[model samples]
Target: MEVFIRHQDKNKRKEEAVNFFIEHKTNSYISHSEIMSGRAKSTTEWSENFADILSAELDEDDCNLITIEDIHNKIIGIAILRIYRKYLIIEDMIVDGSLRGMSLGKKLMDFIHNFAAEQKIKALFLESGINNDKAHSFFEKNGFEKVSVTYIKTLSE
Candidate 1:
């Protein structure tokens, strides 16, 4: 199977890609009780807000959203990125569940690395959930280091 990666337009197709990512991301938390519990407490508002933010990010000059499509033009992966003055950040990445072991994530990361090098970016950064062991392993294998811990607190009004 041949796969091609390109910048995706902010359209219905992009929305589908976002939804696909959200589904997989959410499912990944089923084994992590704390995160899944928080997710289940949220209403549709969370998804709506996330979509708005993702759309806004796509409109920023320093941010990009790329879709990986199969030969038949079906979007099988999505990558969201932001390039800053000194570094590039991968905000989100997801591949079709069935294609996990096929090196698609490596392909996407390589694309980011090359693009950053072209832009003279000095470093790359990303945040993976603490409970996402699979993602952590993948990032480590791709040369990412565990630099910082992100702590979150839930506040209620």
Candidate 2:
């Protein structure tokens, strides 16, 4: 399938991209039991909050929302890159779960790399959830190294 990668048109595509992502959201490859044991807020509230945060990032001057589309103009993937003092951080990236084995992700990474080069960024950074082995492998294969482990503690209010 022919794919086009470009800066996301916030007005035209943000909502569609967000919906697609929420539908396919994963626990980063965690086991079923682990996922079941985890503390998750009401799905409705979580999704609402996520959408708001994502929208805000898209509106930020230092963030670029990149999207990939099929020839039919359907959005297949979305990525948000935030510029920082030392590197370009990939805040979020999601590809349609139905298109898993396809090379759309590699294409998106190549696009990001090229964009970073153009902006003279010396390094790129991102974090994959602790249990997301598929994501870990993909990132490793794409030349990302395991530099640190992020710890998380869910607090109850």
Candidate 3:
């Protein structure tokens, strides 16, 4: 299937993007730190606030909200990227759950790679939930290395 990746026009596509995100949020996870800090107790809670967060990011200069669409112009994937001095961080990335096995995710990653290369960014970084082995495998297959492990300890208040 042919798909195109582009920077999302928030004014025109925010709602569609949010809806698509909500639909696929189940495939994502809330980090242990988020849960321990009460920022979000679950993926559902985290995703419930996605619309507002996405809106804020859309207005940020260093944040890029990208969307991948099919030939029919339907949003099939979304990614939020934050550009830093030497690295581009993928804050969130989701491809339509129904279409998982397809090469769409790789296409999105390729787009990100080119975008970073064009901007002369040195590296790309992202984190996935510890238990998300499938996502880990996918990232590895797409040339991402397991660079670091994040450990969280809930402090007593």
Top candidate when judged by lDDT against the true structure: 3
Better of 2 and 3 by TM-score: 3
TM-score (C-alpha, index-matched) for candidate 2: 0.84
| Sliding window of 10 residues with minimal summed lDDT for model 1 | 39-48
Q: What are the per-residue Cα lDDT tens digits for candidate 3 across 68-117?
A: 99999999999988888989999778898889889888999999999999
Residues 1-157, candidate 1: write the lDDT tens digits.
Answer: 6799887775556677766766666534322222333433332213335555555556677668888888988888888888777888887788887898898888888888888898899999887655678888999999999897755565795
Estimate candidate 2's alpha-carbon lDDT, on a 0 to 1 scale: 0.75
Cα lDDT, all candidates: 0.71, 0.75, 0.79
- Candidate 2, residues 10-52: lDDT per residue as tens digits? 7778788777666767755332222233322432123336666
Question: What's the CA RMSD of model 1 in angstroms?
Answer: 4.6
- Judged by whole-model lDDT over C-alpha atoms, candidate 3 comes out at 0.79
Per-residue lDDT of 2 in model 1: 79
Q: Each candidate: how many clashes?
A: 0, 1, 0
- Preferred candidate (TM-score higher): 1 or 3: 3
Order the candidates by TM-score, highest first. 3, 2, 1
